[model samples]
Target chain A: MNAADVLDGGVLDAARALRERRVSVADLVAESLGRINAISGLNAYVDVFGDQALSLAQAHQTMLDCGYDLGPLHGIPVSLKDNVDMAGVVTTAGSAILKDNVPVADASVVSALKRAGAIVVGKNNMHEFAWGGTTANPHYGTAGNAWDASRSPAGSSGGSASAVAARTVFASIGTDTGGSVRNPAALNGVSGIRPTIGRVSNGGVFPLAWTLDTVGPIAKSSQDCAVVLQAVAGHDPRDLQTSAEPVPDYLAELERPLAGIRIGWIHDYSVKDVQPAVRTAFEAATATFESLGAIVTAVAIPDLDAIVDALVVLDAAEPSALHGRWLRERGDEYGPDVRAQLEAGFVLSAVDYVQAQRYRTHIRARFAEAFRAVDAILTPTLPFTAPRIGQDVIDIGGRDRDVHTANMQFTALASVPGLPALNVPMGFDAGGLPTGLQIITPAFEEGRALRLGHRFQMATTFHLKAPPR
Target chain B: MDETDSIRCRLRAHGIRETEAAVGLAASWLRNAARVRAVVEEVVGPAAGPVTAFTHVPAGLHGEERRERR
Candidate 1:
């Protein structure tokens, strides 16, 4: 297999190859560093730890010589979103305020990945503080979309998605609150999961929303995500929010057959809001699921628009609480847009905050009732292909639409419900850019979503589509 | 909506201090939302059940520690 194929291959496949000693760790890290250097214009990383990643790979090689080995990710290089803390590295959430902020220890997920024998290659850029969906960072630099440099890699986890899609690394970890991970993954034609809340401990990652924030992986396929999930999802005493449940064999779940799986078609949920390109790809995805022997039905649980407001209010409130003092003292350090949103969060009344929580409880119950009749839900991942840079709005049809609004058209619902959602690349647009079809499962049913995604990925060629350098 | 006044009220009431511009935008959203809510009430009528909330925990289940019993 070519270096791209090996790097982009399933983590299990790579592990088997590593176990057999067919591919050396030194060589793999070299190829990844080459890919990052080749695409220097994407600016996917805030700092590329070339020496550190190489040193780790060498250490893994020595481990093999000594007849000792780490688990599945032995010798694989992984990039981390900047918001995640790593000892000796600055955790600049793509802003000047924290640009000089260096961490003395690793984030919980970073420690987990290291224990699995993965190499931390570098820190990825983001839309400052993981607040906005687009990955455009005026401070560090926007991580350009893999297919088109003119368009964005979706953020605030854009850097992680682009680095993986462009073959800069084997896999990367990113945060998802209101679709930070999945948005860029879809935009870049890769795979990412927003695992159920509290499944992965958030201990070391900077807080976006103490209640809603989650850190997840962006990888080449659902299988890759499953491996990363195994490494990262666990309870931590530092993060009391983590569930005390045991981690399952996510890789085994991927091989589960799609037969008899009931996937609900949320076609009309926001059909009017989605772009025609996304709408078409979603229909194709539903057909693919049916052809695989999965029964499908139309269902509507609750208005997503109603749930979105509750999620937004709650998300903004938490982040604003953490950053309010920073913003007040160093207002100029923040980007104008982030400042505006943070400011708005402060004005929300205590009653309004309480009411949003109530609304969330009500919606969760409503969705639980719907899930009783269906195993999964399928929807468009993003409403359209990437819009050009410098244009914060798109003229969809005759009316002007905000780019942020259009980007989250499909993603916001899952975020609000705190359910598991996967963004799997479905197909390319006419311009060769990719569009993703989202597969969503009810809270804690990530295995089912991965199974469905893995099945479709095996049956289709979209997951293999690569952007030319 | 002076920053100092807004900050004082939010801090005292909710332990938060906010900028004036943020409050203005929030107020705009609140105003529009209240209008929409009132209209919905006119059509669907007032809620028949109490607005159940989980604000104050029961004495036995009070804090994150949740007073575990042997």
Candidate 2:
């Protein structure tokens, strides 16, 4: 097969071809680099490690030639969000202030990817310090959506989703503090997973909220995400917060049918004030799941608003504490939005922070109660489709809502309780932009979410839809 | 002092200088935080614990043994 055909195929397909000697790793890397360069206007990449990627590709090819196959991800090309550390490379975290912050060692996730024989193509751009959802970085230019360059990718992992959607690489890793990974994945028509917090190590990655932050995978398909997750989801001694629970066979779980699985539909909170198109897509997804023999039940999360407010408190306060010294010393260097957010964090009282933590326990207990009757919960990833690139206010249900707050409403439901959530492409809006469905499962039950998502993708063609070139 | 003044003082205490407009925004955020805290306090019991608590048990034993004790 030619380079384009191989690049267009899924990661597992590429893995099969590699073992059969149908494609060379060097050609795949070259095609990925060429594609990234060809669509420079997308601004999906912050730094393309062309030389190093090619060298590693050649090395992997030699390993395969010597009958030493690494694994499913062997010889696959993937990108990392700029916030993740790659030794000898600057981990900018999409901020001008951290331009000189280079680590001598790779982050634990990066090391795991390397060990699986995945070649690191480059670093994708992100929102500054991941403080906001839009990937409009002041220092690294705004990353555009693959479907429409003029629209937002619903960041902070915008660039990673864009690359995956544009087929620049097989997959990319992104950090999600508050729906960063899943948000962009929805907007860009891809699949992304935020494993339960502590499922993946946070070592060498920059902090947003110490407790809320998680590293996750964004890819073209749920199966591809499973392949990537299998390589990276495990405990690391370097990150003390990582779970000691053994990582399950995620790929093995993907082919299971959704028969008899109970999915909870948040009747009130998830559907409130959502755009009509998003609501329609979510309803269709619900119907599709029912058609697959899965039982759907209406579940209410009455205190969802309070839980989101608590999320706001913790998300704001933790990042501010992390950047407290810098905000005082070099406050002028940060972008206007992030700087303003950091300043707002200072005004939150100690009582506010402590109450938010207490509220987290309450919300988790509520979800645990809900989970006793349901195996998983389904909701829309975002309340609206991707807005225009730089637009702050969006109309939802005839009222203007702030884009930053609206984007986090449904996403925070899972983030606050540290549950595993998956974003899968459901369908397109009238504007042809993609809308996503979120599947959330209990802690350490990422397999459930992936299984539901995989079954949905198998029965639908939404995930196979590529952006207009 | 009024809430805005209190917020401005807190900002100054942290040595973070900002314009009056920015300080006003911060004050608004603080008001919202106050409302959130009240809502949380209404639902959370006196015996309820925060999620960020430190444990005396080691990391390895915190999972199984802690659950057993509970």
Candidate 3:
């Protein structure tokens, strides 16, 4: 097969071909590098480790010759969002403050990937310190949408989604705090999974909001996401938040049928004020689930708006406390928007932060109660498709809403409760931009989300659709 | 002190030097405080103390495999 065909087939297909000697690891790495260099204008990658990637690929080939197979991800070239450490490389969490801060050890997730034989291709770009949803970064140029270069790939993990969608890399690891990973995946038309918080360690990832942050995979398909999750999902001693629970075989769960599964849709909160196209696509997704023999039900949760308000409090205050010293010493180094947000965090009283957490416990109980009657919950990942680059306000259901709030509303439902959520490409809107279907499962039940996402992909061609190059 | 001035003092106390932008941010907070207060009164119990920790994943729940709880 040709290089384009092999790369477009995604991580799982490429790995199968490698094991069968249909393609060389070095040749695959070369193809990924060539694509990365070709799309430099996307600003998806802040740094490309071409030599290191090739060296790693060569080493994988040597291991294969010795009959030592590491795993499914062996020899696959993957990119890391800049917040993740890579030993000697500068782990700039998309900020000038950490410009010279290089780590001496790899992040636990990165180490797991290395052990699984995945080659590190580069570090992807992100929002400055992951403080914003739009990756229209001041330090690194924005990561443009794969469907339309004039539009944004919503961030802070915009680069990883863009790189995966553009076929520059088979998959990329990204951090999600308040929908950073899934928003970009929705806009760029790829698969992203924000695993249950603490399913993967946050030891070496730069902190945005430690309580809200999670590292996950953005890739070509839900199956690819499961493979990546299988490699990285486990407990680590460094992160106290990580539970000592057993990690399941996520890849093995992907083939489970959709029959007899119960899925819930909460229309009041999930569909309110959404774009018409997104609403239409979401309705079709429910119909698709029903046709696949899954039982779909409508459920309601109390005090959703209150939960969101409390989330705003928690999201704001945590980052403020974390960046307190840096904001005081080098406040001028941060972008004006980020600086404004940090300042807003300063104004929140201790009472406000405590009340928000108490509200979080309340909301957590509500979701837990809802989950007892269903296997998963379904919603639109974002209210709309990719907005025009630099467009701050968007029209949603005849009302003007800030792009950040509109992009974050649906995704934050899962984020607030620390549930595992998956963003699957549903289909394209009128303007040819993709709409996303979000599947959220109970905490640590990432396999349920992936199983449903895999079944959806099998019944549709959305995951296989390529952007106009 | 007025609402804006009160926030300006807090900003300075937090080592923020600039007042104009921070004050503008403070105005929004003051506006939103009414809504935040309503939620706090309704959902947050009076006896509830400051939440210092979060239970991310329940201990007994394993991923997909239902392993015996530790």
| Standalone chain B TM-score for every prediction | 0.43, 0.57, 0.52
* Model number with the top lDDT: 2
What is the Cα-based TM-score of model 1?
0.89
Off-target runs (Cα >4 Å) in candidate 1 are: A2-4, A397-399, B1-70
Tens digits of per-residue lDDT for model 2 on A1-469? 8777888879989998888888899999999999999879988999999999999999999999998899989999999999999999999999999999999999999999999999999999999999999999999999999999999998899999999999999999999988999999999999999988889999999999998999999999888999999999888999888888888888888877788888899878767789999999999999999999999999976667676677788898999899989988898899988898898888887888888888887788787777766788899999999999999999998999989888988899888888889999999999899999999887777887888999999999999999998
RMSD of 3: 2.4
lDDT of 1 by residue, A322-394 (tens): 8877876787777867776787776666666666655555555556666766778788888777877667887
- In Å, residue A130's CA in model 2 sits off its true spot by 0.9
Interface RMSD of 1: 9.2
**lDDT (C-alpha) at residue B10 in model 3:** 83
Each model's DockQ score: 0.12, 0.32, 0.35
| Alpha-carbon deviation at A321 in model 3, angstroms | 1.0
Q: What are the lDDT figures for the candidates, one per model?
A: 0.77, 0.88, 0.85
Cα lDDT tens digits for candidate 3, A258-340: 88888999858777788999999898988988999999998887778765566677788899899989888898888888888
For each candidate in turn, the TM-score is 0.89, 0.96, 0.96
Clash totals in order = 2, 0, 0
